[model samples]
Target: MNPKVKTGISAAQTGLKAVKIGKKALNLKKKLPGEKKKATQKALEKSAKKAAKQEQKTEKKQSCRQRNRRALKNTKGIGRIALAIWNRYF
Candidate 1:
């Protein structure tokens, strides 16, 4: 029922989606000639590593956004309570 809870759930869902998409994209399968197998495999490993690093960066950004949203929500609630108290006493 709380909007804050809804936002937290949405944030978790988005993170899961990002992880799933990243895993799907990194699922590489390519048929190569016997002579080029070693080189292709090496390249694939390098690319997969790069993709994983990028995915980590994206996940970090999403987590940061979620933290910021939660902090903002808490502050807004505190500010409203402060205002109510100020009005009642002054």
Candidate 2:
């Protein structure tokens, strides 16, 4: 394979992975953060709520990570498909 073509395919795969992460994060943020409220209180309850939100954020981050991983894996699979098509035609 041409080095330039390989570079282009890698860049495209990376861009697609980023898009997958962005979509996952946006969807997770929508699912979270809405029903929560802003309030002040004693130390323990405040800390607990803060912890919960932090956990949600962590989960969202992990979800994005998983989505990106899947996208990259799928990108490799698609690259093989493209190669197969190229071999068949040319």
Candidate 3:
């Protein structure tokens, strides 16, 4: 196998190990006592806020059609520079 593939496998293994550790910690937290209702409420609110932001970003990406406008603006700027150079040297 190629050395790059081996390196990638090793990195992935390390990431999986970290994820397992994180999951174990979360499990322990769930088992250990506390106000369960409050924890559940906070978790739900955090997830809702995250989902809202993701939806907003997706909507913006879908409808924010500014690429053509930006391209036109850039061409206008280049044309000005080109004209100035031509006027100065020609």
Indicate which candidate wins on TM-score.
1
lDDT per prediction? 0.69, 0.62, 0.65
lDDT: the better of candidates 1 and 3: 1
Q: Which ten residues in a row have the lowest lDDT in candidate 2?
A: 35-44
Clashing pairs in model 1, backbone N/Cα/C closer than 3 A: none
Q: What is the alpha-carbon lDDT for the whole of candidate 3?
A: 0.65
RMSD (Cα, Å) of candidate 1? 6.3
For model 1, the stretches where C-alpha displacement exceeds 4 angstroms are 1-35
Q: Give the per-residue lDDT of model 3 (tens digit) for 1-90.
A: 554575466557656655665575577567766787457546755655565566557545644545566788999999999999999999
TM-score of 2: 0.50
Q: Which candidate is the best by lDDT?
A: 1
TM-score of each: 0.55, 0.50, 0.37
C-alpha-based local distance difference test score of model 2: 0.62
Model 2, runs deviating above 4 Å: 1-41
Deviation (Å) of 3 in candidate 1: 15
Q: Write the per-residue lDDT of candidate 2 for residues 32-85, one digit (tens) a residue.
A: 554331222233345555655665576567667777988999999999999999
